[model samples]
Target: MNNDILDKITFDTGGLVPAIAQQHDTGEVLMMAWMNRDAVLETLEKGQVCYWSRSRGKLWRKGESSGHVQRLVNFRIDCDGDTLLLLVDQTGVACHTGRHNCFFQSVRDGEVEIISEVEISPDEMYGNKSGGK
Candidate 1:
């Protein structure tokens, strides 16, 4: 892990960059989240995915509570150096809603449709935690 490369990333005014997580083998995009420098460094050092939660205002280790961990396979930066792509080996569900991926909605013909079914229930995933609506 090169600190020089990580330092070159141009974060937004809020000191955050968008990170898109994808399944390495399947190339399926799992989720998109925000990351700060600390999160990036932690992910690289720990071999697990970490994100900066705007709502929580802190570092969020993926699957800290749930068991659906993401093992880092590869990390990439976009051409602008403002965004990241993380190829990971996902363990269980990725979406907080108990879906495989966060992008489960499809917009077609002026209608918003759900493209995927929930693999696990929110109650089962987070217990009493309020899964984002």
Candidate 2:
């Protein structure tokens, strides 16, 4: 929790770094999000995944409202110190679309295809709230 550790990260010109969250046991990537310095410290301090929301322009704690919380198991910084890797225990579905992960689409033969199925409905996850997807 030292300031120096956080300072070592090379944030982008926008003062943000890309953080990738992966399932701890399976090594399956769940999502990719941005994290500011404060977010990195907060996640380490709180033992929860926190991200910087570019659209909302604020700190977004994972599953704060969606009930798909990500519990931090381990944290790693890439060799260049420009990116972060979060090994976490994901509860429920990681994607707001009610999928296990955000990467559900794939580009094969130059055609976009859906590779995964929705485990639950977005309405069920977000309580009939539109724009959750």
Candidate 3:
């Protein structure tokens, strides 16, 4: 693939761009992550979603351990060239908290509330007890 496309993206000072992953068929917004130049190219080349982990400070291949992978269907760039939208085929829960998606919180009656339940336990997903978010 031609790498010239990446030059158009407006990466932040940290050389990162926010990427939003959405379900291709249902259009469900699954999760949000970050990506650097290499991560974007790797995802395009491999046909799987790869992200730059801000916390880990490394390239994080989706489903590297948990077996919940996100396959790329379509990749898009925002008009501002600072954000990305990835249309993906999500295999399982997208959130580390074992929820279906990341945006599981909502405000109802002026109070913050949890809107979703865990589909799988953290131990089941990652083989450890504390499945952090």
- The TM-score obtained by model 3 is 0.95
Model 3 CA deviation exceeding 4 Å by range: 129-133
Worst 10 residues of 3 by lDDT: 124-133
Which clashing pairs does model 1 show?
Answer: none
**TM-scores, one per candidate:** 0.95, 0.94, 0.95
Q: Compared with the true structure, what per-residue lDDT tens digits does model 1 show for residues 1-133?
A: 7888887798999999999999999999999999999999999899999999899899989988887899999989999999999999999999999999999999999999999999998888777787632
lDDT of 1 at 82: 97
lDDT of 3 by residue, 6-63 (tens): 9779999999999999999999999999999999999999999999988778999988
lDDT of 2 by residue, 18-98 (tens): 999999999999999999998999999999999998988999889877888899999999999999999999999988888
Q: Would you list the clashing residue pairs of candidate 2?
A: none
Model 2 vs truth, CA RMSD: 1.4
Best-fitting candidate, measured by lDDT?
A: 1
